[model samples]
Target chain A: MEHTQEEIRKHVKIYISVFAALAALTVITVAVSYLDLPLAGAIALALIIATVKASLVAAFFMHLISEKQIIFWILLLTFAFFLVLLFIPAMTS
Target chain B: MSDMIRYISKPHPVTGVTNAKLGIWCFLASEVMLFGALFSAYILLRTGATEWPVGADLLNVPLATVNTLILIASSVTIVMSWASLAMKDLSRFRIYMGLTILLACAFLVVKGFEYGAKFEHHHFPNSSTFYAIYYTLTGLHGLHIVGGIVVNLYLLFPGSAMWQTEPERFLGRIECAGLYWHFVDLVWIFLFPVLYLL
Candidate 1:
């Protein structure tokens, strides 16, 4: 379906909100780093935070949530490639 | 208006142009694994160091931090470029995409300076395995940045009217490229502490 001009404007609003949230998350993650948390804890917290931020960007900004099944299959193939990467290192290590 | 849409709904998939995005994304996924292993190496080496190079003592964190922020800013610009295209503003699309490319070049220039400064201080990869992985990972990432800049330039030139005409197809390309760029930034986010801050 063709997007109405109003719908496009709404998307821009959502885009701005996602951008603001991502920026805030970056700042908060940096701030949290200064708390002297355990190394594992700090890293875990940062990864969790980054994952959430990336997800928002992916789902909305990248529109992955509305993508075609073929696109999803392509992404899955990429994920499978990542698994191969893990195996190479696992063997080498 | 609704009747206009009923006559022609979906456009045909533009052959390899559609595949181009998936191709880029696949290559990037492989890159993540490559960098992931190197980062894991960094972790192992960091723990093994008898005296971990005090971050403040060995490298210039301030410079690296600026580069990090530069990359993050570029990420936003890249997305904005894609957004402009989606809004069917080709001129705005060109402007933002060009700015993104410039910022990417700036990122590399800063990195080049960092490498030069390190070499001047005899901070070669042989300094330790830590430095080894450090240079290797960042160096590889640097090359990827160069590759990305070239891709963006290719997309911007007048010759790519196919991309210009059907901006949705180009949107997919930009989205894929942005993912790689953000991953580059994400790698740096982790690298900052491991290399400069911690």
Candidate 2:
């Protein structure tokens, strides 16, 4: 799809802001890792921060926020299967 | 025949996206499962083991942090390249795309040094379960970065002529590449904290 110059400029600004946010979050993740929290708590917190960062990249950089429904469905299915994959360990344990 | 051409050249009626776009998303979906399975295996091995080494104690945290930044920067540059093209500025597109490739190379180089250090210290993949997982995860990720660089390089070089002939399709191709690159960066975002910090 053709983008107007204004839209392109807006996207560039968003990209810059997202980059800055990601960098800040990276620092936070590193600092928090050194806090000596319980292992599970640390892993959960780290994954939570990483998820937020991943969401920013996916939503803004990948343009998934405005993506078509078919792609969303595809992702939804993927997420379902991915959860199943993760749960395999729990099932056996 | 016309349907095939339309499938490639125009957006689908149902999806409002091109076939290539849809195909890439599906491919990426499978990739998510692939990596997910590996990560699940990592969890199983870690929990089941009698003793597990802390990640930070074994891996080069400082170098990995730098590589993370480089990958993140590359993600921005790739998106910026697409934005430049969206503005119909081919020159700026080239500059941004060039920077993206350079940053990709920089990440791989740092990764190479990290691997070299591991080998020098006799920390091969078979050294320990942690090392095995470390090498497997990062090596696969490095290969993905290389794959992205190869595509970006083609677009920045010989494949760029499409911009003059079919600017819209060319832009779409770059957008797809940017999506893949961003996904690569996203994987590393998780990998960094999981493998290096946690």
Candidate 3:
């Protein structure tokens, strides 16, 4: 809360860069969808791009990168739970 | 007693509501799983069907393409709204949030049109095994967009003293809302191709 002006400016610069990267990633997603990649390749590419975009939103736009460590663990555990749900059913089938 | 007191004494930088944002985030994670199950089911069913309707034949790709862009744009505006709040620009924050809500409404309108068109063409989910799952998957995502609009409108009002007295905390709530929104957008991103373009 008591950040100096210089510190604030530095954060702003980084945030802008992240937003720009996300925009570029959006363009890439649309472009890649046009290619004739295998189904698995396409799905993998889409997911990878999505992960990069989400990380930018979470880290810079949402400010999670600067947040407390407890919050990080909460986020990580949540994702872990999500993986369990996604894959657990595959075993039975 | 002392540990609880100490925990209460340490306010989060973004919110004083202790675990409010964290709680919201955790809830949204569960939502991801809920949608994930439906999507995975879609993959399995479509794979097994004898005459799977190729997405292009079953969907109006141009219209869905517009809807996709609208959702992705809303994701950007919602994040910008939170950033404006963090920068202490209340007016700008309100404007951004309003735009996000409008964009969300636009998405719903387009979705309604798409559904209407589908019904006109006798494209009900029951029409085929694929349409059944397609409608169910995208329909769930559509409901989420409507939910997001309601949440944003609730936060947009000037009479909400919580936003006035604790700006950072209010912003954190918006951030939590944004997370839910981005997840919804991501689901559509996956669904668009699976149901329309592909």
* Top candidate when judged by lDDT against the true structure: 2
* C-alpha lDDT (0 to 100) for residue A44 of candidate 2: 95
Candidate 2: Cα lDDT at A9 = 89
**Tens-place lDDT digits, model 3, residues B62-147:** 67777777777777788777667767778887898899999889988888898999899898979888788888988888888888
Please report the TM-score between candidate 2 and the true structure: 0.98
The better-scoring model by DockQ among 2 and 3 is: 2
A1-93 per-residue lDDT for model 1 (tens digits): 244556667776776777677667666766776677886786688778767766776676556766666657766876676566546545555
How many Å off is the CA of A58 in candidate 2?
A: 0.4
* Candidate rank order under TM-score: 2, 3, 1
Which rank order by lDDT, best down to worst?
2, 3, 1
Q: Is candidate 1 or candidate 2 better by TM-score?
A: 2
Who is ahead in TM-score, 2 or 3? 2
Candidate with top DockQ is 2
Cα-lDDT of candidate 3: 0.72
User: What are the lDDT figures for the candidates, one per model?
Assistant: 0.69, 0.91, 0.72
The Cα error of candidate 3 at residue B74, in Å, is 1.7
Output the worst ten-in-a-row residue range by lDDT, candidate 1 chain B: B3-12
Global Cα lDDT for candidate 1: 0.69
